[model samples]
Target: MDKDLEHRFITQLEKHQNIVHKVCRIYTSGQDEHNDLFQEITIQLWKAFPKFRGESKFSTWMYRVALNTAITLYRKSKKSVRGDHYEHVLNNLKYNEYNDEEEQQLKLMYDAIKQLSDVEKALIFLYLEDRSYKEISETLGITEVNARVKMNRIKSKLRTILNP
Candidate 1:
């Protein structure tokens, strides 16, 4: 990459690293898997960097690549992974930054999201991140109507999971 583009990529990555972290958290239940997914996302984002035109916000494009990388990486690695360590990590994570109720709710929310299909999880992640239907539709190559419908379904599923 050229100097200007390399600088821009680093700047964008710093700004949007949280998106990759969040996706990795949702897609990979274990620390090792999460780190692997993060690396995969970084690599994919670098590869796709040149194709990023100024048409959409950089974060929006990053979300697409991050989600795609998370799903693909998870699928490719799922068979070899075991989940015995996940509960231990979950227990170790300190949520004292938030109130007890809020922390519990956040954990429950992700637990529910973990059960979703890859497509549903991607839709929910983007929706929760507050992306517009148009941006999501463009990123996912779906119609705006479909994006809206998928988000509605994801919400309903979450409601069922949380309420049940």
Candidate 2:
């Protein structure tokens, strides 16, 4: 790629790298797996960049590529811990702002989310990120109605897991 294009790609990647990290968070178990998946996603994104048509918003496009890469690689790892070790940055920061009860609740929620399938994880992650149904469907290549339906089901599933 030319320097101009390379610079553009690097700028976009740097601006939206958190999307990739969030995808990695939901699909990988530990730092090693997370780093591996992150690198693979970057490679995939770079390979696909040349063909990016700019039809969709860059962040939306980034999410699609990141989610697809994470889900695919996550399925291929036979011994995957399946995001069981995933932790929010807040906890790692040792903020001490949240009490023990809040921390416990957050852990329980994370545990329930970890039990979801890869696709479900992707869906919930997007939904939690405040993406619209249309955008989520676009990112996942599904219909708007399907996105809403799946999100409802996922919420119910999480409720069951966290409650029962």
Candidate 3:
């Protein structure tokens, strides 16, 4: 039974590891920070796995856990984030082929995203993944209406950052 549970957890995590990576990428500035954040989130997910009763999609639950883990550690740690290492992470995360103009735009978008607050970043991350407002609210423990409002604000915030 224990092994079965472990197997299930591993399978689910393997399937959704990108969610974890994306969260870490948003919350962390460098590779070491990203790795540590990812490990901590994985640990939190494992601890919470037994109580996970399938009330939500695994990815949704993962977003909650990952976001919480990042927030908690982010608050606790006094160490300052230093040395932006964009090239390493960006190369790994690249997906689509784009022209030079598109690449510049994408870089600007990520730079703007990095400027957002933690909760705002989480909202944007979930939104980018095409999660519904309902899921966003659930994961963030906000009302659907509030989620909509925040998203609008986030869009405005990103626009200002990108343009200004």
Candidate 4:
């Protein structure tokens, strides 16, 4: 990449890197895995940057690329996430008060999410990030109706997991 392009990419990437971090955290179990996935997503983003025409918002495009990388490209050997690690994650959450009930519920939710399929996880992540159904559909290459249906199903599944 040319210096100008590299500089622009780096600047934009720095501004929107939180998208990558959120995706990594949702997909990976531990800090080490999160770091590895972050690196892989960064590399993929760099490789795909040249092809990124500014048709949509940069963050939207980044979400598509990062989700695709997490779902298809990144190989996750570890499956189960420890509940204690979720306590660590919960500390960083923006909640004003942290009760053990809330923490346990969030941990259960996270554990349940870990059991979901990659596409389902992506849907939940996008929904949690406040992405609209249209944006979720675009990002996942699914129809808007499909995104809504999938999201509803995912929510139901999470509820079942949490209650059961």
Candidate 5:
């Protein structure tokens, strides 16, 4: 990449790193996998950088790239031997600072979310992040009606998991 484009990409990346991190956390159960996914998303974004037009908000474009990278990574990882290690790794992962109740609730939510299928989980993640139905549709290449249907189903699924 040229210096000008490189600088622009870095600046854009810095502004949106949190979005990448949030997606990483939602999609991966293991810290190592999360880091790997983040790197993969960054690489994908850099490669696809030239295709970005100024018509959409940078965050919107980012959501598409990050989601695509994550879904693709998840599919590939599913076929790897190390994929089965996530449960053990997640059980041992530590969090330093949440209060007991908050931490418990968070873990419960994560557990419930992990029970969902990949597509449902993606819809839930986007919904939780407050993406509009149209944007979710565009990101996932589904119709707006399908986005709403999936989100409603995900919510019901989550409720069952949480309340069971």
Candidate 6:
């Protein structure tokens, strides 16, 4: 890549790196795996950057690439230790309780989300990010209707796990 292009890519990536980190947290367990996935996503982003047409928001494009790389390249290991960083961040949520009741509830919700399949996780991640159905459809290569249906199912599944 040319210096100008490389500089631009780095600047844009630095601005949106939090998107990468969030995807890593959702997709990987264990610190080592999270780091590995983050690097892999960055590499994928750099490779794909040359082709980015600026037709969408950079963060939206970044999410598509990052989510695809994570889904394809970073299969969670069976022996993987769940990442603690998620809980650390959740611990700081405004609603966190001194008695830790909210913390416990969040832990249960996170565990339930953890049990979701990779594709479902991607869907929920996009949903939680407040991506429009059209954007989720574009990112996931599904129809808007399918995205909605799948989101409904994912919500039902999570509700079952969290409530049961």
Find the candidate with the highest TM-score and give its number.
Answer: 3
Pairs with backbone N, CA or C atoms under 3 Å apart (clashes), candidate 4: none
**Which tens-of-lDDT digit does each residue in 1-164 have in candidate 4?**
27666666777777787888778767877767776676667767777888999999999999999998887654555333234523432333332221235335466667888889899999998898899999999989999999999999999999888788
Q: List the residue pairs that clash in candidate 5.
A: none
Candidate 1 stretches with Cα past 4 Å from truth are 78-105
**Whole-model Cα lDDT of every candidate shown, in order:** 0.75, 0.76, 0.79, 0.76, 0.73, 0.76
Q: How many backbone clashes does candidate 5 have?
A: 0
Q: For residues 139-158, could you state the per-residue lDDT of candidate 2 as single tens digits? A: 99999999899999999999
What are the runs in model 3 whose C-alpha is more than 4 Å off? 78-105
Q: Worst ten-residue run, lDDT, model 5?
A: 89-98
Better of 2 and 3 by TM-score: 3
Q: Per-residue lDDT for 1-164 in model 3, tens only?
A: 37677778877877788888778877877668877777677777877899999999999999999998898789787343332432233233323221234335456677889899889989999999999999999999999999999999999999999888
Candidate 6 positional error at 120, Å: 0.7
- The alpha-carbon RMSD values of the candidates against the true structure, listed in the order shown, are 7.7, 7.8, 7.4, 8.4, 7.6, 8.2
lDDT of 5: 0.73
Top-lDDT structure, candidate number: 3
Cα-based lDDT at residue 82, candidate 5: 38
lDDT of 6 by residue, 3-23 (tens): 677667777877788788778
Tell me the deviation in Å of residue 48 in model 3. 0.6
User: Taking the tens digit of each residue's C-alpha lDDT, what string does model 1 give over 1-164?
Assistant: 27677667767777677787788878877667776676667767777788988788888888888888777766776433333434332233332221234335578788999999999988888888888899889878899999999888888988998898
Global CA lDDT of candidate 6, please?
0.76
